[model samples]
Target chain A: MARQLYELCGTDPARVFSPFCWRSRFALAHKGLDFESIPWRFTETERLAFAKHDKVPVLVDGARVVPDSFAIARYLDEAYPERPSLMHGRAHAYRFIQSWTGTVFHAALIRLIVSDVPPLLDEKARSYFIESRQQRFGMKLAEVTRDREARLPEFRAMLSPLRDAVLAQPFLGGDAPDYADHVVMGAFMWARGTSPLRLLAEDDPVWSWRERLLDAYGGIARATPRAEA
Target chain B: MARQLYELCGTDPARVFSPFCWRSRFALAHKGLDFESIPWRFTETERLAFAKHDKVPVLVDGARVVPDSFAIARYLDEAYPERPSLMHGRAHAYRFIQSWTGTVFHAALIRLIVSDVPPLLDEKARSYFIESRQQRFGMKLAEVTRDREARLPEFRAMLSPLRDAVLAQPFLGGDAPDYADHVVMGAFMWARGTSPLRLLAEDDPVWSWRERLLDAYGGIARATPRAEA
Candidate 1:
């Protein structure tokens, strides 16, 4: 069986946008592996039951079923040892970077781009996304990102560690993109797919670094459709 | 020639207190290397003219002299490849973690503990410390830290990345503490050495992780004399 990766998408299946799914997408591309994108929508637990996971980023590798972005990254490195390594056999070395990107960076980003997400979902997925997100945020979807532009400064400030690292070297992985870069770039891809907000200044080193990653791996991430800015 | 590390000290030469110095100290211990600590005062840049650098963590290892903490870490791994690896030969993997520690974690810590530092110094060093720090802060040293207790919540929130990582794993480097662990632990050592401020809550996972690191490498970090809490 051909490899398949179930990704979270919206009204347009080509607009796959879950940050976790993007992590796996970049990981696969980085490993020089090919997989078909199986468009999974919001609240699609039944579709992912085969993997015993409710998440969209379920990977069907031949007969093997793998779920979760970090797990998939680990699996790809182990299964294709011949490919370029992601965590380089020291998986723990990348865990803090993953945690920081997920907990801190994404938390700040959602407030800036989340309000734009519902419009891209189908009617059924839109309801699910809005209710679930609003409940988590304890506010209306629109209210959460009403003044997003005003909050951009604080959000950009949170990118200092990333900014400093890229300014010192080419990528977080030093000279090239690695699993650490994939994890963070995944978050940027999320904002790119849904919101048109200017997250980083054009002059910012982070913006330049993102541009470099976008062009990495035969332009895998760069090919993704971006929302109008 | 004996390996000697020039470390910042207050009145008591035994109190090696600079956080950057602690990084090298722990890195050397992790590599099973021994070095004599040469006590350095705040205004003693003249004493380090031979190293061509005005830094507290000047490491004179036999004939090779290393001047920065990050450089010392790389040198230890390169110079002693037979020893336990620090970067595991992927030095870039650790850069973001180090950048986060140096830029975010240390910035928050100084505002909380900068005032406590000067009193630990003798008269000559005390005057220099206060003047330099005040000039940088653009205010009196005491004012920089005044009402710091009220900002404890913000400081702890800044540690979300560290808190999240240690909670999920034993150390940032996974099962065993690595150079990533050493970098952040260096920041904690700074607070412990110069201030009585309770930086970490009793129940924080970071606090427990710090306990583990404090006892690491034959308690080299834990044995350092800390300010009374």
Candidate 2:
């Protein structure tokens, strides 16, 4: 399918961001599409800027307000078919990887994140969830993170199948990075960069795969600054 | 975009059975496409009948295998363009609802199913997980279900926004069932049918939405049955 052309839009650089936002950025980078990342703050006043959900990762490309990671990925794929394809020709493999990474892998990863690391969050989200944490779990941020710490052995065990799958492939699919790689690259990047555990891309093939992907994307050094507010 | 024909070749009913599968079924129904639902038992020996992933929701029409819910949805959207559109002119709204129902809503609901309700599982899945449940969660089926029972307050709270959204629209996308509606209907049906939360329909508009879609699909009773194993 030929991709349609749409101007890329996103949050500005000066604002604090979330992993979901980062995923969209990485996808744009992967496709080599230059978009304007308009900075957005998650506050009551920001409703007019975004939508009712009060979330980042809301892509405003012209008249399009593409929300959610998968949709953003789809929009990119359809909008930029001239670029590298995130979806391989084998529809089943591409979709399987997309769903696994986006849905199953993401679920486990997010649970670990919110439960395990609050301090790592930027001031905005951390400050927002502080009271809710104590009220709901009867614990402070440290307690929650520590409790998550205890589950590492179990978490690592869970991630093994994923590790094996990616290790077997050169770039999340067979030879090139597809949408699954992008979905995972964003989350895995956060987990590897921000969290205490950082279980991914450490040894042998998994580590090497991550390194190659990073290398292919200009090694993260050339990232465009978030669009100015 | 027209939905290209794909084959779902298999013979094991329970192996690939899930809410997502039901969603795909309804999509086929919506398109009024004459297709076969091939069930397959995922025993080690029979796994090779399919490709490597050995997963259900494999959409095979002719030589193509479309896996994962999003890809399948997109494929359907493309192949069956003349059919009622999955998204209205509001691409953002369509994308948001699709992701919300398929990813976020599906995540929370599936966790409860895997962690809480094992006995209610079909015989195959139950036997597969019985021995490992203790090592994973320090509890068996009954205890897990009890834990889920305690979380009702949290579930209801988490679902408030979604519930309100559905109540706002006659359908999730407004006035008619779209791809997102099918995505959510599958999950809600599984949860409501199998849990104490079966009364979701009385309180929420989603239940009625599901029934209307099913009614549109010839009320499920007259739907074709899978061939003999």
Candidate 3:
């Protein structure tokens, strides 16, 4: 069985965007492993029944199946021990970082760029995305991101820890990208693929760090399709 | 040149409460090193002149003087490499977690507990603390803590990352505590030593984690004097 990763995308399969999928994708690239991308869209639970999960970042590596970005990253590190380590055998230390990125960083991000996402999806996924998201937020899709420009400063302020760390070191993992870097940069990938609100200022260290990650691994992330604001 | 740690104290010498000093204290305890505590009060810059720092966490280890808490932790790991590793040779990976604790976690905490601190000091130190803190906050200390009870929910919400992490693993460093634990627990030490505002609810995972740390290293942190609210 060939290794394959299911990634969430829009109408154009070339544009992979889900933050969780980007984490798994970066983890694979960091481990120097090559896998084919299977573009999975929203509301495609039936397509993932083989994995017994409905997540986009489902990894089918030979006979073993893995779901969830964090689980897949750990699996990659364990399976490919000879490769450059993503967790470096301290995977548990990253659990807080993962939680912060998911609950705090990514939570702040969606409010700023969520409305920009629907148009990139196909008609069925677009409708499903809008309805599900609106129900989740208990508001109209546009209302969730209203006055986003005005709220950008607060969102950036929420990233004070990341900004300070990036300014002091090249990456959160330091000297090189690790699972910590993948966790954060995945959010940036989501922003890059879907939104054009210009999340980071030109002078910000995080912006520079993002540029470095985009150029990493032969510029795989940089080559992805971006939606202009 | 006996090893001595200059720790911030109030009217009672046992009431060492500086958050940064607690980081150094915990780091020292984690390394299983013995050091005498030199109680230093506010407005005692002349006492720290030898270290060329205006902080309380001055570690005079034999002929060497280390000032900052972060620096002292690094110095401890380097000075005693054979001891249980505090950073596990990845000090750089801790920068973001440290920044987050310092800026986001500690910043939120001081607002709830600053007013509770004045009564702990001597007359001169109390006056000095009041003037300096009021100048910093641009308000009376009491005003800074006015309705602190009402803000407890917001403060607890700010701890979502820590709570989630502790629930998943026994410590931020996994099975055992490390510098990451010291950095965050230092903030809790500050609260415990100075105020009894009940920062964490009895059932909070962070509360249990704090209990474990308090019992760690022969109950050094638990032995400190606390100001009941």
Best by TM-score: 1
Ranked by TM-score, the better of candidates 1 and 3 is: 1
Candidate with more favorable, higher TM-score: 2 or 3:
3
Q: Write the per-residue lDDT of candidate 1 for residues A85-130, one digit (tens) a residue.
A: 9889988788899889978999999999999999999999999999
Off by over 4 Å in 1: none
Off by over 4 Å in 2: A1-17, A34-140, A153-185, A190-196, A199-213, A221-229, B1-24, B35-201, B204-209, B216-218, B221-229
By lDDT, the best candidate is 3
Work out the TM-score per prediction: 0.98, 0.46, 0.97
The DockQ ranking, best first, is 3, 1, 2
Cα-based lDDT for every prediction: 0.91, 0.54, 0.92
Which runs of model 3 end up more than 4 angstroms from their true locations? none
Q: What fraction of the true interface contacts does model 1 reproduce? A: 0.82
CAPRI-wise, candidate 2 is incorrect
Models, CA RMSD each: 1.0, 10.4, 1.3
| Model 2 Cα lDDT, one tens digit per residue, B78-129 | 8878986554322222333344454456656655655434444456655655
iRMSD in angstroms, per model: 1.0, 12.4, 0.7
Candidate 3: tens digits of C-alpha lDDT, residues A74-141: 89988999999998888888988888998899889999889999999999999999999899999987
